[model samples]
Target: MKTYDILILGGGAAGFFTAINVAEANPRLKIAILERGKDVLTKVRISGGGRCNVTHACFDPDELVKFYPRGEKELRGPFHTFASGDTIEWFERHGVELKIEEDGRMFPVSDSSQTIIECFLEATKKCKIDVLTTQSVQSVYQGENHWKVDTNQEQFSCQKLVFATGSNPKMWELLQGLGHSIVEPVPSLFTFNIKDNRIKNLPGVSALASVNVNGTKFESAGPLLITHWGMSGPAILKLSAWGARILAQKNYQFGITVNWLHTSDAEEAEQILRDIKQNQPKKAVVSKSPFDFPNRLWESLVTASGIPSEQKWADLSKTQLQKLSTELTQSKFNVNGKSTFKEEFVTAGGIDLKEVNFKTMESKVLPNVYFSGEILNIDAITGGFNFQNAWTGAFILARSIS
Candidate 1:
């Protein structure tokens, strides 16, 4: 059996990070990363639509933890130690400069994920960390003190093992056999699939809206985008992230109440309509979009209100005004399915946080076994929070092992 000091499974964001940091920390300690696929960093190449959202600009630990629906409480202390500033500085030191966007998402200034891949690849070669690809992990067992890992091609022994598999069921099963519990994994960060005429044929329409999943306590406020298939964007993505577990329990069938204007209430929306009628009485209700919504969305809303396009605001009846208010403030739509969000696939389950030590990303049930990344029950909404979790946990693990 080939023996090494440490072995990392799943050659992904966390796996490569742990390997690089550990090797750099101690030159003498041997480290190897086993990747199942022919290539490594496939997800990294495609994350953020190929730009690679490295981290969020949120420097505050408390605020950063709020983005994660799971592991928020568990990762509270971890974020304080390795927050976004630490990440920014670390990348800068490594020749990869990240720029923060207006929305606080940080990405490589070069706007290419290949920069990060090259950095990691160079780091491993410089640090003498082995990168083994096409090596599939079939089973893992703990000997008296070390781990005996069986792969498709070979078996190896390592004094320490780290798992960074993101939403991979086989890895979860392997951990389960080792006496560690695996939480039931569910999809997160998905866009809602709604078949409603109000948003149909309006693929490019978007507005500042707040969505509440009716019958559940899930609500999110942000810019919502209308697509041919359904609704998406920050608000919808946040709702999906926060309500992953609940929506899964509901079998992805639920109702969502969307406030297009994000106004206070129905009365407030009604008043806004009344003001529009009072001010722009001569203009068509569809022509004068009082809200900042796109004309397509405004026209759709007006049509859905059972009002003609040529109907002037002055000709609108009280019932039409009330119905329009309801449509703008509390438009309920049926969500029948979900679609993955552009190369970013996240899940809300993994190793139960209770069985792992968040301080070290180490498994409490196993000896010398550490974890980082999506293998754990920690996931965030959109933006760069998910990658931040992986980077934070992997950094901690590297330092702990070193």
Candidate 2:
């Protein structure tokens, strides 16, 4: 059987980061990455629509931890150790310049994920770290003072073993065999599917709004995009991440309230509507939208409020005004299902967080065993936050190993 000082499973972001950092810290130690698929860094190549959201612009560790719905408390200390600023400096030193977008998402100046992938590949080659692909892990266990991992190709052992395989069920099962608790994976960062007239033919229509999963405390406020399937964007994605478990328990069938005006108070919206009626009495209610959002959306809401297309603001009755106010401030929709956000898929479960040490990113249940990335019960909403989590954990784990 072949052997190495370090063996990292999963050649994705976390795995690659850990391997490269470990090799850099301990140049004399032998290291290898075992990848199941023929291609490594597939997720990195496709993230951010091929742009590769390297990290978010948030530099504060306290604020950065807020993005992660699951790993918030546990990651507080780790982020302080290696946050977004550290990530930027690391990439800069590696000859990859990162630029921050208006939305606070940082991407390579090249705007191509290939740049990031190529950088990783070059680093591995330079560090003499073996990146063995198509080596699916069969089983892994501790033996004497080393960790033994059997794969489809061959058997390998290492003094330090790391599992960065994000959301792999087979790996979770293997970990469970070794006395680790799996959190039962569930879908996170998904868009709601709703077939509603208010949103029909309104694909791509986006606005700043507040959304709440009806009958629950899960609520978010941000830019909500009306998609062909239903609603998406930061507002909905935040709610989806924060409520992943609860929504899964409900079987993805639930009700939600959309505050079109970005506020929950219907009375406040009603007062604004009354003022509009008094100021623009002769103007057709559907002719122009009084709000800052898209007029097409306003027209749809007006029609849904039982107002005639040609009806002027002067002819609006009290009930019609009230209905319009409610529709504007608190429109309700029944979500029947969900759709994955673009090509990105994240999960809300993995090895339980309690089983790992955040400071060292080492397994508390087993010595010399480490985990990083989604293998732990940690995930964040969209926007480069997930990648940041991977970097932070991998860096900390690499330090511990070295």
Candidate 3:
């Protein structure tokens, strides 16, 4: 049996971050990370379509926590300890320069996730931490002094154990065995699926939108995309995150009201339509797109409003104008289903945060056992926020786990 002072399960972002920081905090302690997969950091490699969004530009801990749907209150104190600013400085110190885009997502200047992976691997090597791949953990039980972990290849023991396995059903079973409550995992950050003809063949059309789940209080405002399947982009993704649990309860079948203009008042949209009709009577209703919307989408909206393509703006009746205004302001679509946004499938459930000590990210019920990343019931809207959670928890766990 291999024994180490510290054992970290699942060698993804959180696991590696914890292992590296722990080794740095205590150079004498031996640390090893056991990865079930043949490769490590697969998610990081594919995140942001291989660019790997490292962290967001939000520096304030209070403002930062707002992005998270779950664990917002729990992560408040932890973020103060190791937040986005610390993340930026940490990576910069490691020779991986990060550049923040206009949308506030920070990535390696090289625009490659490999830079981040290389930095971690080099840091671990410098710290002499052992990382074992293809080490699938089967069971975990606490011994009187150290933790006992049985794996497919071998048995291992450690003075401290950390699980960053991230949404793995088998790991949740292990956590349940260890007396930790596992919040039922549900899909988050998914795009709505609609078969409405208004968006058919309008895959590339996009506009700023405010999307709200009709019955729920959940809502989001940002750029919205008319995907080949349905709707996506920041607005839809944020709504998906905020309503992950409730929508799951509804079986992914729900109604969403979309404000394509993202404005609260429809009266302003009506005025814009009237002004267009008065000023450009000779122009086709679809000719000069208003509201800064894409030309194709304006055409689609006009068609949906029953406005004839060749009809002049001057020929619009009172009913046609009202219909056009409604379509622009509050276009309702039946969200019959959902589709994956990119390849990332974020979940809004995991180890219940109430059972975790935010100060150390250690289990309140179990000693010498810690968790980070998606293994915990913490998730956020699409962006670098998810990765930031992993960094914050792992850093705290590294410092607190003696």
Candidate 4:
């Protein structure tokens, strides 16, 4: 049996980072990364449309924790240890310069995920970390003072084992067999599938809007995009993360209320529409929408609201005007399902955070066993926050284990 000081059971961001940190911290300590997938960092290669959103620019630990829907309270301690600033510095030190966008999302200046992957590979190589591809670990066991890892290839022993296998069900089962409590996993960061023409044909059109899920409980305001299937972008993604559990409870079936104008209230938005109608009563409703919405979207919204485009605002009844106001300001759509955005899909639940020490991501129930990344019940919104959790968790565990 091959033996090492530490055995990491995944070669993604968390596994690689843990190996690099441990190796760098203790040169004599042997470390190996076992990855089941053919290619390492497959998700990283495809995340953020291949740009690899490294981290968010949010530096404050309190403010940063809010982005994570699952591990917000538990991640407070970990974020303080290694926040987004630490991530930026880590990448910068490794020869990959990252730039933050106006929306606070940080990406490599090279604008290629290869840059991040190459940097991780280079770091692993420099630290003398052994990476074995196509090695899928079937189970892990604790023996006296060491861990025995079983894989298809062979069995290995280690002083410590880190389960960085991400959100895979098999990985969770392996841990659960060893007496770890796992929070039921569910999909997060998905776009809503609304089969409505108001947003369908106007695919790429975006508007600054506020989305209120089921009138209350969850709300997010930002740039919203019209997709071929439904609505998306920052606002929708945020709503999805915050309401992930609720949506799952309802089987992804719910109604979404969109405040198109993003005004203070629906009454204010209605007043704005009323003023537009009064000023442009003679203008063709099809030709001129009350708001700055796209022409195609305006026509669709008008048609969906059952309002006649040819009818002058002066000739329209109070009921028709109220209906148009409802369609524009408080548009409600039936969300039948969910669709993944780009190549970025995240799971919301994993090993419960309470069972793991956030300071080091080490299991409180099991000694010398650590957890990190999405494998834990920690996930954030679409912006680089999720990746930041991986970095933060890995850093904490690596430091503790070393």
Best by lDDT: 2
The per-prediction tally of clashing pairs is 0, 0, 0, 0
How does each model score on lDDT? 0.91, 0.95, 0.91, 0.86
- Give per-residue CA lDDT, model 2, range 57-124, as digits (tens): 99999999999999999999999899999999999999999999999999999999999999999999
lDDT of 4 by residue, 1-402 (tens): 999999998899888988988888889999999999888999899988999999999999999999988888988888888999999998888899999899899999999999999999999888888899889887787799999988889999999999899989999987888788999987889899999767767889888888888846899999999888888899999998988888899898899898777764656756776786788777766676557666777788777768777866666666766777787778888999999877787988889888998777889888999997899998999889988999999999999989
* Local lDDT at 193 for model 4: 92
* Deviation from native of the Cα of residue 401 in model 4, angstroms: 1.2
Worst 10 residues of 3 by lDDT: 258-267
TM-scores for candidates 1 onward, in order: 0.98, 0.99, 0.98, 0.96
The window of 10 residues in a row where model 4 has the poorest summed lDDT is 264-273
Model 2, residue 216: C-alpha shift (Å) = 0.5
Pairs clashing within candidate 1: none
Q: Please identify model 3 stretches exceeding 4 Å from their true place.
A: none
Report how far residue 361 has shifted in candidate 2, in Å: 0.9
TM-score of 3: 0.98
Inter-residue clash pairs, candidate 2? none
lDDT of 4 at 38: 85
> Which runs of model 1 end up more than 4 angstroms from their true locations?
none
